[model samples]
Target: MAKDKKYRKKKLGSYPLASVVFSVTLALFVMGLFGLLIITTQNLTQLIQENIEVQVFLQKNLSENEVVKITKILSSKDYVNKKAGVPQLALITKEEAAETFIAETGEDFVEFLGDNPLRDVITVKISPDFQATENLAEIKKEIGFIRGVYEVTYIENLVHSINKNVKKISYVLIGFTVILLFTVVILINNTIKLALFSQRFLIRSMQLVGATSSFIRKPFLSRASMFGLTSGVLASALLWGLLQLVSSEVEGMMELLHLEQLLILGGSLLLVGLLVGFMSTFAAIKKYMKMSLDELY
Candidate 1:
């Protein structure tokens, strides 16, 4: 009787606690990685959209007052990008345009033609929400109608291509995200279920001794919840360390990391870990409790 009781005690105490924690932490870490990728993709998209600029060519020989008036009008429009509470509008003089062209092309067209053919321009950066191709077309038409405006032009093909590629990339990322989340849930569930398998006979003995279902479940549920919470914290800490390492090693990576989104992702990982651990443990215990004594063999 003493040997049998000692063996049971050993069995109950020897549950693979380290393996369970390691498995849960690994699963949570993978999910966190996917979350970071999604956040980075969104930040990249916003950066690209914000960089899209529209060039407004002014008619040659406009008076200084007319130029000032046109700039003020463009600046006041809602379609223009605003940064630091200032409109993203800049005036490029004909001489400045000529210099830029000469520097880029390595040929002085003004000197060759004996005249500067470049027009004064006002470059306006469109807000991200208005950076779509169709919206840009409408903006160009509206601005082209203004008096003293020679033309409104931009890189139409570039914008269209970027929009098309970004759409495809977004679709791929979303699909990958869904698949990864499903995988994480399954992996975590299986890990917890297997961990509880060793406790089945112990649970059965408790049931045979007249322990209430709630009483039997309470200890297991509490431990599983703690396991999950600890795993999540460990996983999150590792992820944060990884982020810091990447940001320090890779140029421009910090620009793409969104703090608010990352915080939300970390919280979500913790919630997922806690729920999966608790539910899997409860299910496993219930299954053992319902089995006959002979089933324990």
Candidate 2:
């Protein structure tokens, strides 16, 4: 029983129960959290970009035929956003615009000026792909060329600000992800190395008994892989729990979180865990296998 216990302990690298598993699971969980942040940020950016609208003010007193033609032309353009095959464009007649103005300010502008000065405006939301300043400028020029169209206008400064800030945020997230990846690799590597430090004597004993490197490495590698897989599963569960809690507390976050993306991130964690575990264990085993007795002591 004593010898059997000793052998089993040796096989485990003499690691304290749960130490290696806990360390690996914590690292994977942190990485998963960061991945969720990146995904949410991207979704929010796209949502904001899609909401931007451009105003197309029409020439006064256009006939019904002319107005219908303008609507059809704008709707046919590739840049216009659509939902359920209907273009995301709305027409506000001069009278409606005046009514809205008066409702908001409690002043009847038509009564004050004796004539409504508001022109008919058609507001169309452009697709997220064309929200940039240059793209909006091109779109405005194209819309202006249509007959009976007075002018096309949008918030130039707002568009520029959104594009600029999105680029900045993207760069920062990418840089942080790279750094986190490097850190996680080192963290997992050192963790495995520390766990195997106690197994030096056992490895040397196996080596003295004429055991081949592959024979000695098989059990250690297998257990390391198991530990990695367990850690990955635990990490994924934690991530899912976090997502659920956040979505419940924060409105609209559920829509931002995508199942496909979460699945991919979870898969990536499993892959990272297995690869790192196998490689780190192999390196640690090889180091102990080559160490002299004096060094082992």
Candidate 3:
């Protein structure tokens, strides 16, 4: 019977170590998942931003000098930051525009025209943030009102739809992140509790020996804090590894994940681990504190 009791004591003594390992592993997994979410959303945003375009039709009578002037004016606008702070404007000369249409339709009517009927067109790429259909329409109206612009064509409906869809996707991502966070908290709490459980009897024994509740709680809190700190480091390491792997396969992804963002993410994970470990330790101690010796047996 004494040997059996000794074995039980040994098992209980090792519980905190096992719990700490479990908490750290779980934290690492959660951090990796959050990193993936950040990377994917950033890539999607960039892809959508690059696809928004605007086309400006020049007046039929406008000369090459006039077209160049308009291009310069448009390039100076504040919204041109979509592409390296330079406006994505392409000056399609009348001849080139005609050739493009002819090539697309394979039309042989080049010889029948009195002159190149196509006007000089300036193509503009808009930023994704301004892609709301109504907003884009207002912008089109504004552009159309320009003195030399014959027409401004932008797919307002398409841009509005894209914005709406992107908003919905963002909401879904937020919901999933919340769920993931809660799941991580619960898993960490349980793992830490199991680790603290081993010390419950020791805590009770101390209580019988007239150890103050605060005194009994000190060692557990210290151990739990250590576990929390270690888990946070583990999470950070995991996040770094996952981001490295993702960067290897995707170009320009490092731009989205700045040091500030990574620090915020790591800080949150660490805070979570600390809170879980402390709360679990406190709860375990309280449970044993209120128990009778018979109850413990």
Instruction: State how far residue 199 of model 2 sits from its true place (Å).
Output: 1.3
Query: By the TM-score metric, which is better: model 1 or model 3?
Result: 1
TM-score of each: 0.89, 0.89, 0.77
State the lDDT of candidate 1 residue by residue for 27-131, as single tens digits: 999899888888898899888888889999999889999999999999999999999989998999999988888899999998899999889999999997887
lDDT for 138 in candidate 1 is 96
The residue pairs that clash in candidate 1, if any, are none
Question: Please, what's the RMSD in Å of model 1?
Answer: 2.9
Best by the TM-score measure = 2
Task: Report the number of the highest-lDDT candidate.
Answer: 2
Lowest lDDT 10-mer window, candidate 1? Answer: 8-17
Q: For all candidates, what are the clash counts?
A: 0, 0, 0
Instruction: Order the numbered candidates by lDDT, best leading.
Output: 2, 1, 3
The whole-model lDDT of each prediction reads: 0.88, 0.90, 0.75
Whole-structure CA lDDT of model 1:
0.88
Model 2 TM-score relative to the real fold: 0.89
Clashing pairs in 2: none
Cα displacement (Å) at residue 97, model 2? 3.8
